[model samples]
Target: MDIKQLQADIAAAVRGNDVLKCEVQNALDALSCATPKLKYLEIHVLKKDENINQFTNDLQECMKELGVLKGILPKVF
Candidate 1:
């Protein structure tokens, strides 16, 4: 190939590489921005799960107490 043609090819390749580098950098920045939000969402979900578990336990206790009260009291109907 002629020297001019070779230089043109090298310049095109360098531009392509720069474009790819920018794309990669943009993807990394997006992930960096999303990571903290993801962590916060995870922590919020865990807290809600804990609250649900506590509510379930409390409901179970109430059911047991109701059962005991039913045994102690007579039906009116």
Candidate 2:
């Protein structure tokens, strides 16, 4: 999806119910794993790249703050 859509999805997921705890943790871990690439993207990409970085940062923050909204997939439900 697009950056704005992804950002909105991540925000909504972050505020979802507590059943997503493990997913949240996984998301945080995923962000950590992508940190280097994200940095590279910031350095080499254009203005559109900024949107990705912003979205990723927001996702990372949401994962960190909510702690229960990462992988709330059908398997969990």
Best by lDDT: 1
What's model 1's lDDT at 6? Answer: 100
Query: For candidate 1, lDDT tens digit of each residue in 1-77?
Result: 99999999999999999999999999999999999999999999999999999999999999999999998787644
Indicate the residue-level lDDT of 5 in model 1.
100
Model 2, range 1-77, lDDT digits (tens) per residue? 89999999988887775558878899999999899998978777777788899999999998876665554554588
TM-score of each: 0.92, 0.30
Decoy 1 TM-score against native:
0.92
Worst 10 residues of 1 by lDDT: 68-77
lDDT (CA) for every model shown? 0.98, 0.82
Q: After superposition, how far is residue 66 of candidate 2 from its true place, in Å?
A: 62
User: Candidate 1: misplaced stretches above 4 Å?
Assistant: 75-77
